[model samples]
Target: MDLKGKTIAILATNGFEQSELEVPRDRLKQAGATVHVISPTAGEIKGWDKKDWGRPVTVDKTLDQVSSSDYDALVLPGGQINPDLLRLEPRALSFIKEVFNAKKVVAAVCHAPWLLIETGIAKGRKMTSYKSIKTDVINAGAAWEDSAVVVDQGIITSRNPGDLEAFSAKIIEEVKEGRHVQRNAA
Candidate 1:
């Protein structure tokens, strides 16, 4: 029930879904893990609430300052803009790929699976995402489902903010179980 010595990284830039990022970060920390808000920028990143921009969350480190090996897990909080913007960054895709290859737990919510798609890790996993991007997920070869949370190997995904509790709980559970084996690796 505790993550006393774990370190988790929440990767995002501006336009993340507010609750999707905050809820898990706070919950993970309260469970005794050290969580860092890593972004493409150093300073603060603003989030997107339902209809407009939300408050800013401070960045603990920039993408260039950290490595995937230092983390036990990586989280990607989704908002339409956040994942779209991140998809355009080569470094972000590379970082995600590194994390996956290292077999660390990677949790994404809402539209965040867009990242897993970009990294090619979604090709054979069972996953879920905000309904709007269900096709994109399927196109990426993921076995998409409509569940609140879907985990295949080390990747954990949820539909939207409405699934936060389950999503966070699944992450905590998976992290505690430690890294996964790449069952279908080529």
Candidate 2:
């Protein structure tokens, strides 16, 4: 997975799933990609573990400081609060739109598919998410699956933390494939 020139943006906010963000960040970095932790706030963002608050991850850039074109791919980590908060932010939604418009990979896992739905990009896309949100994705026009990971066009999704291994591998594969010209706007 030679991604030497690739840049990935991990978008999150307070309450992001700790493992969902950290695991992929490390894996992508090891695969030779520069991963930026972009958030709605600067300084740092707290993460959510299984039941309580987890460690804080420093913010590399705030939403207002960067554009989607700055990166080769976008990653949205899911935790109940993270996606719920991001779905309401106009800037975050716009950033997501721009990335998809550029035909770059947009990877989400677990509840992160909520962000995809809000961007209106989930329509007709094949994806997998935390089982609790399967209906949500389907209602958004997505074809939901129960698999550990699913990639359609440049959109990649997985079920939950247990699926992170497959999730990370699929992301690396998609990034290596670069743009997907078949991806249509939502």
Candidate 3:
């Protein structure tokens, strides 16, 4: 789909799954969207490959540099460490909530849904995540699914790296569709 002139934000920090961030960010940019990698840390953040540390992604904007209004969509790329660190960050969670409340699309893959849970935005949404976190997602009040990708009122989620293509495609679709009336806004 055409995303020319759209600005998307990928929020991540050290230890994020390398492919999760890279694949989707690259896909979005290629689709003609202006994608920004935002992070709590300025400069760069490390990525976690399957077994070892992978490459680092440059942070286009620090958390304090932009507001939710600055983005058309927000993406959370999960790794065991990245979301774990971000979920506890008040600024990060607040920025996510602002984006959510604005009815903008928010996408998460793998364990990234943890950020949604921490922000109280996962409650009552239909979503999916890395299998290991199924219980955590259910506990957060989401009607969990086992599909490769799930979209509920503009909040998109997927299971793992294997699902990245679909996850990224859905983000573009949702953004092209514009804002959704979030049925269960936190």
Off by more than 4 A, model 1: 184-186
Tell me model 1's lDDT, rounded to 2 decimals. 0.93
Which 10 consecutive residues of model 1 have the lowest summed lDDT? 177-186
Which pairs clash in the backbone of model 2? 124-141
Q: Candidates ranked by TM-score, best first? A: 2, 3, 1
Per-model tally of clashing residue pairs:
0, 1, 0
Greater-lDDT candidate between 1 and 2: 2
* Lowest lDDT 10-residue stretch of candidate 3: 177-186
Question: Candidate 2: where is the Cα deviation over 4 Å?
Answer: none
lDDT of 2 by residue, 127-169 (tens): 8999999999999999999999999998999999998988998
For model 1, what is the error of residue 82's alpha carbon versus the real structure, in angstroms, after optimal superposition? Answer: 0.3
Regions of model 3 farther than 4 Å from truth: none
Candidate 1 structure quality by residue, lDDT tens digits, 54-121: 99999999999999989999999999999999999999888888888888899999999999998888
Task: Give me the candidate number with maximum TM-score.
Answer: 2
